[model samples]
Target: MTNDAPLVPRRVLLRTAAVLGAAVTTRLLTAGPAAAPGGPAPSAGPPSAAGPSAATPVRPDHRLRPLAGHAAAEGRRRLPTPVRTRPVLRMPGAGHPMVLTFDDGPDPRYTPPILDLLRRHHVRATFFVCGEMAEHQGGLLRRMVDEGHVIGNHSWSHPLLTRASTAVVRAELERTSEAVERAVGQHPQWMRAPYGAWNRRVFRLGAELGMDAFAWTVDSLDWTEPGTRTIIDRVLNGAGPGVIVLAHDAGGDRSQTVTALRTYLPRLLADGHRFTVPVRGEV
Candidate 1:
């Protein structure tokens, strides 16, 4: 015989059980420590200098149990691996030496103007290029090298963190390094993590790959498209000896950044602040 529909009370109970089961599963998956063989034990205290006291013992909580060998291993397998950071380049010499770095491109639109200003000022700056962009705009990259400007790897896609999984992080940096090498005919000696997100893996991987990690002390934040006058004001106000000013050449219209550079480069030069790069074995 065919079975009839379930009774109302029984149906409600089954639905509630299913919902509770799902909630429990989700909590367990996203919850505290991983499940183990036994409940969590009270942490042992350090030895007392005088002597041990007769204190009441606290019972372990089964729900807060520490993971066992197999379970802990499995839990670890699902967790993200810790990423080691690359060693950062320290500022060279006590004398006034500032570095100017442009990121996210080698855009023909803005880069040429910026390059022209640098050339006019007879100063060299660093260009951190994305692999894909650089591959497509090899001419700009070539000009940068030929003009004595330093080219640094900013990663292939300009990822926010260079501490992603080893493969992904390496690919991000290596692809750009290869692109820069192809265009400039030399491997980059420096790298800057996108968004300045650095970690141990970023440090170790960059160093292992023979690139020094560089972070900016003065961020122009030109990506926000601030007015040209405001951009110039920020740079002029923040200019100091050994300060690294961060700017963008691409990722959007960077007219303000380009214009600001034109205004400040000459002014900074007049102010006796020499724009320069860190030399090997200097800092």
Candidate 2:
């Protein structure tokens, strides 16, 4: 069973508050203008799921905007220089892409069905699996990769990294990466902070681990168990060029997410939003 704790209503409000404080005001972390959402899918073929294992350090991709223009002085610990202070709200210049991301997952109850739905639609999405959750669902993680979905680190226990000690933060991220590597033979290249809470240290440590941070432009709010129609409306209403939509496959009942995706994915695709996953080296 997935060990994730249910995100209560009170916690939801608190977390949302935290994210608004630290995020949403930041600039989009992009290289240049690419195609908008109404453009053709990339010629590179379907989204690639293969990435370096946790042991290998992956460089930050276009999703990150460094706090400064230059690298830090040498002799400092081997961290990714010019770490970001925020997460990528949208994928700029990537071409008419609608990125779908799920957090706190690999839950046996809900994740499989969502995967099935995505497969039926010939779509690929990102799954930010918590380490504790991923450790138990290695098969699901593997299935996600085999089926062309990107798996990213959502931390081990889904704690607020901004409030945890540096050691705790490192352990949370590193342990989760190791779990993912063990399950899928690849470490994540992307991560999303729990509750959207972030600090400079969180960004530096994530970069050190060879991962970039990604926030969302549209939140389905499925975790709240809001009606399926409500979730669909949020996603469809928020749909735009290069928007990253956030949903969840775990942490609680996700039937609404599944049902809502069944409705909205087709609508968005019909409307010319091509579903794709973010990859390193794309600007």
Candidate 3:
């Protein structure tokens, strides 16, 4: 499909401030490198396929469960309604609930292997994909949806929203959401600011755009090109209930990120951690 293709049939209505109800100001969240653009945008590559681990039987559920219910029970509320004062840093649920998220990608080289490994292990993850990248990697986005993974808006260009005007921020978010919906036939319900720099504009704008803002509790530091073992160690070390792990798939050489997952994902599973995607009002 062309980038100029019309929007999906569904109309995304922007919620007015009154409709949004009482507003609250959240603390700004920041981490990792600032003003970093997503690494090389995904280039065209072969259609996605199950990778080397395809031969392995896919586990049903991978002994995991969705954390939305548990989180809801914990009374994690929705955004722009009662209005969140802060982005969610961790998921709440029983049984060592954890979320693994990838940012800035859909890179054909690294993402396919990551997907393959997740498929092989029957694990589901969240990919916060950039619009420039997702626009070209529609197939990857569709595959992510088809496989029951969550796709979130990582902005059109991975800009630091804190530094951008309201219009620029909206465009960054809206364009990315449009790109994703055009590709996968649904709007993203979640969004993350690049480098984790989030301000009131981000929180309010994301809610107006119908997304829950998210920040990570654990930074894998994978984007640093730290050795593969270090990535694995970071993830394993940070493993716990209600933790969101931040890692990357595209931006620079992500071979290390891919390699680390192969080592750590199963270890997480073995340790009785159920990998889950967070739901709105529940994350």
Candidate 4:
């Protein structure tokens, strides 16, 4: 101990470190534009439900599965599909369904509260998780499944996919898929590129990994640390059928996002908007 050292317990240091983890996660957000497709934020609009999609019945295993032996390579399968040039902007189905997607998370502190809210409301949403975070918090991933939430790949580390090398990009996507597989007994079928950036390589690699690309229709701008009311306004104003609302559970001060979810979710539900996950048939 140093002469000037003030006594502090190891347990206290650990607890303090844990409390500040959410702020630490914020650095990852600056890796790229929060919504990608960099430009002025678009005016909020209700998502329209009109697009060509295949009619595949929902998979029975869509719910959470028991954790088993994890073999990343065997767990992942190569899928061949028509090349996609862009991300799926909205869902194409009936019942006026709107999708809720949280990116860059599964944080120990923030994710649990968000998950609790979703559970209380009896709603199912999608989480686009990072591999780096997922590996450390596999239990959160398992809880997501157990609660009937969808897990999608958000890459290993948040990076601009278009700027990275082909090999680098592949690793980012594949590693996240594998980590998720190792956690939930199934790889994520839905994959979202960080910063909403997309390219030929991204689309090709995603399909090959048996994944589909999902982008948001409404940018909550929650990543900006916008006020709680602003986040709610964005979602409420943008409410429409088949629309995908983008928010984050990790990556800095998601308390606002969490609160906004509780506020807007029920209002949207009362307005006859159903929350659903994206299926690959559309891709």
lDDT of 1: 0.62
Model 4 per-residue lDDT tens digits across residues 1-283: 0111112332243234334553444443346444122121221222221111223332223322211222122235644556678778877765446779998877777888998887776666789987877766666776676565778898887777889998999899989887787666678877888778889999988888878788888889886777999999999999987788889887666789989988998898677666655545553
The TM-score of predicted model 2 comes to 0.73
The local lDDT score (0 to 100) that residue 137 gets in candidate 2 is 66
For candidate 4, list the clashing residue pairs, or say none: 36-195
Error of 3 at 144 (Å): 0.1
Better of 1 and 4 by lDDT: 4
TM-score of each: 0.68, 0.73, 0.73, 0.74
Please name the candidate that would achieve the greatest TM-score relative to the true structure: 4
Q: Candidate 1 — which residues are off by over 4 angstroms?
A: 1-90
Error of 2 at 105 (Å): 0.5
- The backbone clash count of each candidate, in order, is 12, 4, 2, 1
Those runs of model 2 whose alpha carbons end farther than 4 Å from true positions after fitting are 1-82
**Cα lDDT, model 1, residue 279:** 38
Q: Is candidate 1 or candidate 3 better by TM-score?
A: 3
lDDT of 4: 0.69
